[model samples]
Target: MQPWETRLEEFIAQQYGLSFDTLTKAIGKGPRAASKLAQRLKKTGRAEVARVDCGSPGPWRNSANFDDPGEVPHGPLWIFSERPIAWGYLEFDPGEWRPKASTTAHLTAVTELRLALTGLDTDPRVWTSERLLRRRLKSETGRVEVHIHDAWVRDFTDADKVWAVEVELSRKFGEGRLARALSAALDAADRSELAGVLYFVRGAGLRRAVEVAATRLAHQRDVDHLPNLEIHDLDITLAQKGMRS
Candidate 1:
């Protein structure tokens, strides 16, 4: 495999899927080049192509069922600028697992964040993926279950300290799942699991939900147990860093 081909696999390994445009931007190639690269990966059985939005975020990606399954179309993604896209048809890793179409942007968001911090470099102490964190936290928790954030980040200004990152795309309270999770997270922070926690929320509703959840959890536990919890609007946060939202 060529160096770029290896990089392509690395990207898929870290991010569940990404648009051809995203690949274009990351690899300094054009859409057509991205298309060819996708085909190459697909030929090697390492990737597959499909849209994320049947027109939802960019077009319905996989809302298609097997019976009349819509085409897993292939084409170049839209790239009007250097900014990476958060949604669109994608060339994705093939496996038993598939992320939901609606959350494809969520995966993109996380990918963009990683790119901003460390590009394609692998350094767990600097940026640990949630995939890896799952094992680490599971073993650390033992019987004391704790909420796992999306990823862990080394503070940009202070490399020695690490913080957990949560990308909140929607409200989890309505599903009856966030409160206990939030409380458990607070407990983990109290136990000094990491330096702190950061939440990047997709909307005002999510921002409010997180605020309320943190407040209630803080009260239930000690307010000091909040562990430097910080929340920011996802788009604005990314914009501040000149990254794609």
Candidate 2:
């Protein structure tokens, strides 16, 4: 396979599937070109459209729980082959993978960030899915049952630092869960297991909440006034692909 084609497959297999726009962005191809490539891969036994195989709103969509039938939770998904490519730091078994009906937004958002960061001219960031972080945290730190964040990142120029990126579309933490979750992830930061923890929130309320949580945690841990946590607007970057105030 060509280098770009290999990248396309890698992106698709990373999440077991990806939207056409994501594939296009990741492979640096136009939509039409990406369409052609998807077709070629389909014909070549590498991929198949989910709608065709599973039927619309079939098992894959998991839309039965929604009250509004017109609301399409996610774009048409393109399912790929079960063949594993052994993505660096990421662990995925395509054959046994089943994407939850609710996580489509989160999953796609992650790939968008991956594409945007990959396009950076300098110090490009490498995004690893939560799967890899989970395995690595357990194996390296012997910390099991920890709440893994959305994604982990490593900049090309900085090999020593591994950062955690959390995308919060809605309120993810409760009063108690907030402290516990941040505590677990921040513990990694304290031990130098994670260089930084970044929370990308959808709106002001969510952003403020995350910020407050970080502050409280810092006070509790007696964190050296130099905090390693930061909260940012998700849409502030190209990854969100929308307007922000």
Candidate 3:
């Protein structure tokens, strides 16, 4: 296998999957170069790369506005092939499909994913976006439980400094959901080497709600051992970072 092919496989294996734009950035190449490499790897017959179609049609209007070419029917993300590759990695079989994502939710997730990519430009650590993060965390937890966070990031400077990132669009959390989220945070913090949990919410109302809920839970002596919870307004922060431009 070629060196770029091996790097592509490692990148996909680490992040689970990534869009063409992010892949380009991760590999320090232009879109055309990255696309060609992806194509060549698939053509090798030794790689098992699969495209994940982003089927949302609105809420962001132009799905391809963000560095995606208009060629692909649905803006797609590529994951390493499920079959084993030239590197002698074991076969990776994907599981049953989950329910479809709503246009709004999917768009919001894509925005968050882009913001995560922006972070990679400066941060030396690695980022595991959404579904991949869920899958990896599930496996880490014995494959019997589900993770609730949107992403998990590790600081390159400190391998022990791991952060669980959650991007909330507009879901109203009741007491039950809040309790479960808190419990999940506490359990993960206690059992793992997590440094903190970060919540990137869409609005001030949601941010305040999360802050209040997490604060209340943290104040409880029983749950005081949870990781530090930090909340930020997603849209405002993204704008401040000039990512929207």
lDDT of 3 by residue, 78-158 (tens): 435433441233233444332223333443454345444444332224665554555456665457365555566775577
Model 2 residue-pair collision total: 0
* TM-score of every candidate relative to the true structure: 0.70, 0.72, 0.60
The lDDT for every candidate, in the order shown, is 0.61, 0.61, 0.55
Q: Give the lDDT of residue 112 in candidate 2.
A: 71
Q: Which ten residues in a row have the lowest lDDT in candidate 1?
A: 80-89
Candidate 3 lDDT score relative to the true structure: 0.55
Give candidate 1 regions above 4 Å deviation: 1-5, 50-95, 138-146, 175-177, 189-192
* Candidate 2 lDDT over residue span 139-226, tens digit each: 5556655667777778457888878877778776555676677677666655647787877777788778777777777777787433
TM-score of 1: 0.70
Per-residue lDDT of 1-245 in model 1, one digit per residue for the tens?
88755655655555656665567656766766777776666565556565433343333233222113655433323211111121221222222444455666667778776766667665667777765565466654443255667788888788778787777777775563777766556556557557777778888887888888888777876664465788888877667665653
How far is 184's C-alpha from truth in model 3 (Å)? 1.5
Clashes of each: 10, 0, 2
Which 10 consecutive residues of model 3 have the lowest summed lDDT? 58-67
